[model samples]
Target chain A: MNDLAFRLRDARATLSAVAVFVALFALYTLNHPAGFSANVVQTAANKGVLLAFVAVGQTFVVLTAGIDLSVGAVFILANCLASVVVTGSPGAVALGVAAVLGTGLACGLANGALVVYGRLQPIVATIASGAIYFGLALALRPEPGGDVDSTLADAVTGQLAFGVPASAVVLLAVMLLVWVPFRRSLIGRAVYAVGSAEASAYLSGLPIRRARLLAYASAGLFSAMGGLMLAFFTYSGEASASNASTYTLDSIAAIVIGGVSLFGGAGSAVGAVFGALIFRTINDLLFVFDLDPLWQPLFLGLVLLGAVSLGSARLLRLKNRLELFGS
Target chain B: MTVPTTPVAPAPASPPMSAPARRRFDPAVATAFGCIVALLLLGSLYSTRFLSPDYLLQQLQVGSFLALVATGLMVVVLLGQIDLSVPWIVTVGGMMATAAAGHGPLGAALAIPFGVLCGVAFGLFNGLGVAYLRVPSMIFTLGVDAVAQGLMVLKTGGSAPQDMATPLMRDLATGRALGPVPNAVWVWLLVGTATSFLLSRTTYGRAVYAVGNREAAAYLSGVRTRRVTLAAFALSGGLSALSGALLAGYSGKAYQGMGDGYLLPAIAAVVLGGTSILGGRGTYLGTTAGVILITLLQSILSVVQMPDAGRQVIYGAVILAMLLLYGRGAKIGA
Candidate 1:
């Protein structure tokens, strides 16, 4: 009973995020012109999964009480690289995937090395690295053009049997294969420990630096996965500054809505996936209602602000105001 | 695993020298000056025209916009909080000023102040969220930024805004004054003077540094930390708005995304000035040097016709180098 209770407590944020996502999704489908069809679901899933992968990658870093502002740039970089390479035969496509993932790992490692070894702040370090990554992307694809293997892209992005979305399944598989094992491992626990209290984690002999480095590496890997997905979806690569920035901002929002604390040491990738889905639903809702797309940012902004305010509501109950500064 | 230590000069002056006075004469300021001199020499290698008084003054004029934004950023950062809403607040100021000026004579008269007032209001909202509600400043300010962008978009119907700047604004921003100096430089000097005075002479400034150094401790010492945070954010907002308005005037029109370029550079300038990103240490003089350096760098990059990618790469690399250099001994995070 005690174990179950602790588990529930641990998953509280994720559960809340799930509830919010379900509610938003229901409203979206009810109002969607197509009305809960598999087609709508697939389209939404495909879009949401892009951000989901990025947000999940972000979760790894945020869990360690740090942030990776370069995820979007890395995503764009991987997309550009994949567009150039993820063509030809199956063997060639496989190699291309490996190369793209490797590039992402290198980027993440660079960010980790700067933060952990060079002793720069994560925010500033990532901002700098993000620019570098975007620069590389721009150099690779100054203008959007290139191709992915159509067969591979179709297989991955296409619908599965029973009218299910393949992308949603991929997201689940990723969670099971990557996130579950990470969450169960000692190193994963170290990531959480470091995020919760870096000094305490260090004093307790946790390998904080290694955990942090791994977190960043995984972030890079996942964002690269997102990039590959983007290549598959778009059938080409474009090094778009606006898209990169939007993804970066949206990933943060998704993480927040997904119940992952920005301060770290808590939350799950599952929550983040749900957050991304909810965010996507907002776009669908806007579309279905036929409102001017101009109002989208405003509506989204209000929701984001509301969600953030809700998260901070606990502060009002604090007896001592000084505690506010510490958190 | 070697920790870098900042080597402090060992009591070179007399014992009677005050600690604040000593800090005011930080070696960072000296380094900033050194960097300006070195960069200028580098610029001269490109052409003698780079060293011309007219060219240097032109660069200073261009840099003033960044310097103004950095002034406000320095205040909020000094309190260990950041304002990411700077971009849209700048837009709001510029757009509002331009729209108002289009309304006729009275509107033209109120245009600049009107834009600045919008910034102050937005800043207050940011302050309320971070200070009163205790939202983390980063996320809160970002949310505010999104809302501001949305509002601006809605106001302009997602196209380029229609209004242009008043002649007065254009003159203030781009006109020549005192013979050779650009009017923008004069405006920057005014903002700089007020900022320096606020940081050095006022009790509130002392409160800001103290709160930034350690907010909980400052509260314990009876400082109203919340009020200090609110004021800092408000000042930051107002300044960002003022800068935006100036930018609009300089460009001769207000548009949808005029504020985008200033956000990162403003933060970069503040941090480059040796003001701790983590807060509680820095000087406006250093920020001034930082603004000048960044502006000159931009001019040089443009002169060399470096592609956008190359420029971004250099910018990011330089920022990382600066962070490593300045923050070698600074302890960051909660």
Candidate 2:
């Protein structure tokens, strides 16, 4: 009975967010010019997957009660590096992919080291690292033009059999390979324990530091994957500060919409993916409805505020005002 | 629901000292002073022109803008909260002031106040979200930021404004009085002094620090934590808006994204001034020094012809190094 209750509680936020997304997606499909068509789905999938990968990364760090503001920087860094390195022969492209991912891991490790060992606040530390990463990206691609391995890019970004999005398939493959294994691992449980109650987790002899480190490192790895996908989509690299900052903000929005608590310790990468899709669909919905592009930011802001307000509804029921501070 | 056996304790380990010592000397201020002197020496090595009053004062004029924004950010930071709506609030202030100025003499005269009031109103919205709604300040301010951006975009119709700054604004921003000192520097000094007084001398200031240290405890001890939070945020907004209005005056017109570059630097400046990022500890003098340091650093970087990428890298590295240095002593999230 206790185990059942725990599972239900854990799933509640994710479930509600999913319900909201489903309704919105339905609304989007109904209004779109080519309603429910493969082309529409593929386009939405392509756009959504980039944020999904980054949101998944954000989930890892936020789950540990920390945030990785550097994810977007790493994403852009990977994009620039990949554009430069992922050209030439097929063999060379593979090496480039590895190198891009490796750089992302290094960035994540740097953030983790500062937060865990140097004892700097996660937000500020990542903000600093993010600047460095973005600087490196700007140096790599001073202008916006570069070439990627077209064959590899096309294979990953194109439609699969029967009009399925190859991007969607790749996203699923990633979840299976990365998130699922981590979710089941002992370290995964420790990540939750630490977020929920650090003192208790420490008392239980958990490898608290290692769990936090792994969470940050994995976040970096996923962010790099997102970057690679971005390069594939654009077929070039642009070190635009505005774009990097937007992605960072959007990733946070995705996590919130996906039912991940900013206060930490609950949510899944799958839920985050759903959240990213929902956020992207909102943008797509604007297009279908023919709203002014100027209205998009305002509409997004309202949605975010409403979602956050809804999340805070639990505060009203508290008996002690002290609980208000913690919540 | 069963409460955990051991309650999650707050992170106050060994307080930096047994009691808050009333030390006349702050190491942060002293260090900042030293850095300023060191930089002057270093820059003179590049060119004798660097030591000229005209050149140094010019840097101060520009530094004044950042110092104004940092003043507000420091207040919010003191409450252990952050306000990310600064960029847009700034834009709104400048836009509103400049747009208002085009109407009539009254509009021109009230342009600065009109801009500041706009910021105060937005700050109230930010405050309500944080204090009353219990929304996290970071996310709430970000949402406010987007809303502000949209409003500005709609108002401007996706282009530069058709209006320009009034003569009064132009004078306040660019005109110099007292011979060598730019008018903006005087304005910055005035704002800095007022902020220092508010943070160090007033009852509200004491309440701010108390709330920052521990909100629940402060509340229990009869501090109106919500009111303090609301006031701090409002003040922060007003100051940021004031800076924006001055910037409009400086440039002689309002433009989009005028405040984009200020956000990170303002935050960094406040932190550099020895104001804790986590809040409840810091001084305005430190922030002032930090602003000067940052401005001088920018001048130095540009003199060397470093690319934008290199400048950003150095800024980021500086933030990280400062945090590590300051944070090592504080038991953050142990």
Candidate 3:
């Protein structure tokens, strides 16, 4: 019973996030003009999955108590790169994907090096690196035109069996292949330890540097994946400042809503995926309710504020004021 | 096995500093000033016009906008908190001021103050969340920024706002009230002086540094840390709004995303000025140097006619290099 209780507690944030997404999604479908159609689900899934990928990436860094502000920039850079190279024959597309992913890894490793080795603060370091990444994206696509391999794009973005989104399936596959194994690994445990209490973790002889490096590298890889998906979805790439900043902010929001502590050392990528879905659903909810498009930012903002405020409510329960400063 | 308890010995005291009489000059501030001079020289190589007093004064005028924004950011940074709501608060200030101006002459006269007050209100909201609710200032301010963005969008209906800057605002922002010196530059100097005085001379300023250094310790010492945080954020918001209002005046109109370009640059200037990102350790002199360095660099980049991409790359690279030079020694944690 104790074990079960501990497990439940561990999963509480993720579960609540899942519940919120379900409730919001139900409202969305119920109010949709077309009503719960595969097309509607597929479109929503496609959009949500893009943010989900970035959020998952953000989760890795956030789990280590650091943030990857460059994730969105890397995502956009990958989009630009993929649009240029993820075309032509199958082998060419494969090579292009590898190159894009490699770039993401390089970017992540750079951030890791700056924070871990160079001893720079994560926030300022990432801000500077994010600028560099966005610059590269701008250089790659001076204009807003490029093409992706249509066949691959269609296959990835299209609906699959039983009206399931291919993008959703891909997301599940990533969670299973990437997040699950990582979660069960030694380094992953170290990542959690480091976030929970870095000094103690270091004193305990954990691989602090390696764990942080891997976390940041994985963030880069996942952001790259998101960028690739974006290329497929849009069939082109643009070095859009608005899109880059929006995704970065939204990814942070999704992670927060997903119950991942900004203080780090808690939560799962699964929660972040749900959080991303919930965020995407807010837009759809507005659409279905016939609200002005201009109201979207306000609605999204309110939801974010509510979610964040709800999370911080636990602060009121602390008996000692000193405990307020603990985390 | 019985464990024997031993009494802990007092820690040995170290010797007193031999250099207690050393001057208070900060090398970081010196280095920043050095960079600013180097930038001016480099720009002169591209165009002799850069060395001309007219051009240099003009750059300072243009830089005052950013300087004002960074002044606010420095206060918040000193408090060991950040306000991501700066961008939207800035926009809200500009838009609201212009919107107010549309009412009449009285409304026009009150526009700038109205805009700044709106920003103060948003800052208070951010402070409440961070101080009382204990939400991370980063995410809390970001949420507030979104709300501000949404409100602006709803008001403007996703288009350019119709209101124009009041004549007085235009006069203050773009006018050369005292010879070649822009009135905006004078305004910035005034704010800067007040800030310098606040950070160095006031008891509240000392408390801000104390709270930033260690909140629990500050609290134990009877410092009203929460109120300090609140006041710092409010000041940051007001200044950011003031900068935005000036920007609107300079441009003769307010628009969506008008404040977008200032956030990163303002932050960069603050940090570049040798202000600690983690809070509690920096000088206003350093920030002033940082603001001047950034302005000169921008002018040089434009003089060379570098592409936007290259400019961004160089911009990021320079900030990173400077950070690597002085902003090292942080541990591997948020």
Best by TM-score: 3
**lDDT at residue B195 of model 1 (Cα atoms):** 89
Q: Please, what is the whole-model Cα lDDT of each candidate in the order they appear?
A: 0.88, 0.87, 0.90
- Stretches off by above 4 angstroms in model 1 are B1-18, B158-162, B329-334
Residue-level lDDT of model 1, residues B143-236, one tens digit each, is 9999999999999994555579999889989999578899999999998998899898899989999999999989999999999999999999
lDDT of 3 by residue, B1-334 (tens): 5886797877645334343222157777888888888787877887799889989888988999899889989989998788888888989989999999988888998999999999999988988999889899889999999999999999999566557999888998999988889999999999999999998889899998898788999899999889999999899999989988998999999888999988888888888888888888888989999899888888788779999999989988988998888778645444
TM-score of each: 0.95, 0.95, 0.96
Residue A62, model 3, lDDT: 95
**Every model's DockQ:** 0.63, 0.56, 0.71
Q: Per-residue lDDT tens digits of candidate 2, residues A1-327?
A: 699998988788777778878899889999988998888888989999999999999999999888888899999999998889998988999999999999989888888888888987787788888999999999999999899999999988999989999999999998999888888898999998888888788889999999989989988888999999999998898898987888888898899889887777888888899999999988888888999988888888888778777867887798998887773
Q: What TM-score does chain A of model 1 get?
A: 0.98
Q: After superposition, how far is residue B333 of candidate 3 from its true place, in Å?
A: 13
Error of 3 at A306 (Å): 1.0
What tens digits encode model 1's per-residue C-alpha lDDT throughout A266-305?
8898999998888888877898888889999899889889
How good is model 2 by TM-score?
0.95
